[model samples]
Target: MKKRSLLFGLMATLVLSFASSAVADTKRVLILQSYHAEYPWVTDVNQGIRDALEEERFTEGDNLTLTTFYMDTKRHTDDAWKQAKAREALALIKSLSPDVIVASDDNAQSLVVRYLKDTSWPVVFTGVNADPRDYGFLDSLEAPGHNVTGCLERERFQGSIRLLKRVIPDASRIAVISDNGPTSRPILRRIKTQATESNLNITGIKAASSFEEWKQFVREMQTRADALVVVTYHVVTNEKGEEVPPGEVLRWTLENNRLPEVGFWKWAVEDGLLLSEAISGFQQGYHAGTLAAFILDGQAPREFAVTTPQRGERCINLSRAEALGIAIPRDLQTVTTLFKTQRVVK
Candidate 1:
């Protein structure tokens, strides 16, 4: 009986030790987004992260503990709110001490990761539209000498414009409009450069700060330009300086604007835009997630070079095409993804 009890005690001790060791060996990661989870970009990026992590055999609730934090700057773009959310993210980071942090978008890098540099923590950032050096994240794009490195977002401006011309066959003068936010500023510049290179005439460009301003801009552009290129309206605000919901912004724009609208995001086509050569949010997040996985497996962040993820879907909204009185060329149809009217503006 004594020997039996002793044997049982030994087995229990071994099991306890093994459990503790397993827990100690587990890797933890934290994904930080600048926007809410429901945002299509955020959702796509997160799915990419999950897929990459799984490819690397890091499954959450098994050998890895993954957590996510959303700053939600897209919904609440006030200056005070931005600071508060950054502080909130910082506090969470301090509490969790995750092995690696995956930050998505400009707000995450500019607001949160800016303060976390020169630390032991490895950070992988994705979907950064701004020049990364502007945030002081790296020594250089080619060789990031810090514990931070990841993916950059490249909008397929020329490709999308050429495709738009093919579909419309007469869209010479373009009017480009986006919100006057830090993230959109760089993209606006790039679009102008692309237009010049492609010899496409750009008649007007406006970055509206408020919904009223956006509406006015859209209305005026109808006469000034042949086609409308909608880049982003995430930070468009009300008179009270609060961000207008993105859905309202798009619906209002689509309902009122009758010109051919070209976008660079899948959500735009999914919403009601005429066409887009969309950047893949999934590729952005997947590359960042791959970097995070590598860092967790003892690879240094600096070893990876910063790069632009591959271009995503070339999409045409059939409903939008019908409304605009344009038929998608069958050859173009074969090359690009097609969407039915997801939302009826009328």
Candidate 2:
């Protein structure tokens, strides 16, 4: 009887040790977002990352430790604020020492990734509009050769333009407008190289410096262009150098603009832009998350080539469509998600 009891106790101890070991093997991932938490882009991207991580059996608190930091650059576009946030983020990263990092958008890459390039920690970036070479974070897209690689987000301007032509057969000329910011610079560069409208002509690419300049551009485009391709106006400033509210900017544009506006994001279309086959923010995050998961599972970032997510969503604003008196075809209507009222974010 004593021998049997001794054997049972040893077996129980072994089982407990095995159980603890299995549960203690946790992977930590940190996500760095360029915008605020309340922003739709951040929300969608975070959700996509969560889903992708869960798909790879990395559930939070079970086997995964997931954390996020938002820079809130959109609301405050000054140079001082951006640099400060970048330093703060780097300190947080050092403190946490996460196994993998996912950086979203151009600012995060330019400001944050530049510091950690070719470092020990593996990094996956999403929604990066600028050419990777510009940041010098990796060797190349095909053969990254280093520990940083992920999604390169390019606007599907051709798709959006084609949809616009289908909607408005006579639309011929378009003018692109957005705030003068780091993100818009790449877009303008890409527009010169890739955005070719066979049936329509691109009038110009204008980056507004101030609220007055933004208003002037919108009013001036009424006579010079057929449609306006709006990128982003989050950083537009007022007379006193204060950043104007983006929601206010959108409301004014929706109320005053006569030409149809094409956007490259779902939140833009929902907020007031006439139409867009917007790039899928969700897919961007999912792709980045996938890369992080693979890195956590013993794969190096250099082993995988950089990729661009090709998914897009067709979004239409019903109120804007009705206001402009443009009719979306029956087939197109079936394919799109329409918003009845413009969502004005304050």
lDDT of 2 at 103: 95
TM-score of each: 0.95, 0.94
TM-score of 2: 0.94
lDDT of 1 at 121: 84
Clashing pairs in 1: none
lDDT of 1 at 145: 92
Tens-digit lDDT string for candidate 1 (61-170): 88899999999888787789999999999999999999999999999999999888888889999999998888887999999999899889988888788778798777
Each candidate: what lDDT? Answer: 0.89, 0.89
What are the RMSDs of all candidates, in order?
1.9, 1.9
Candidate 2: deviation at residue 336, Å?
1.3
Flag regions of model 1 displaced more than 4 Å. Answer: 240-242, 344-346
Report the number of the highest-TM-score candidate: 1
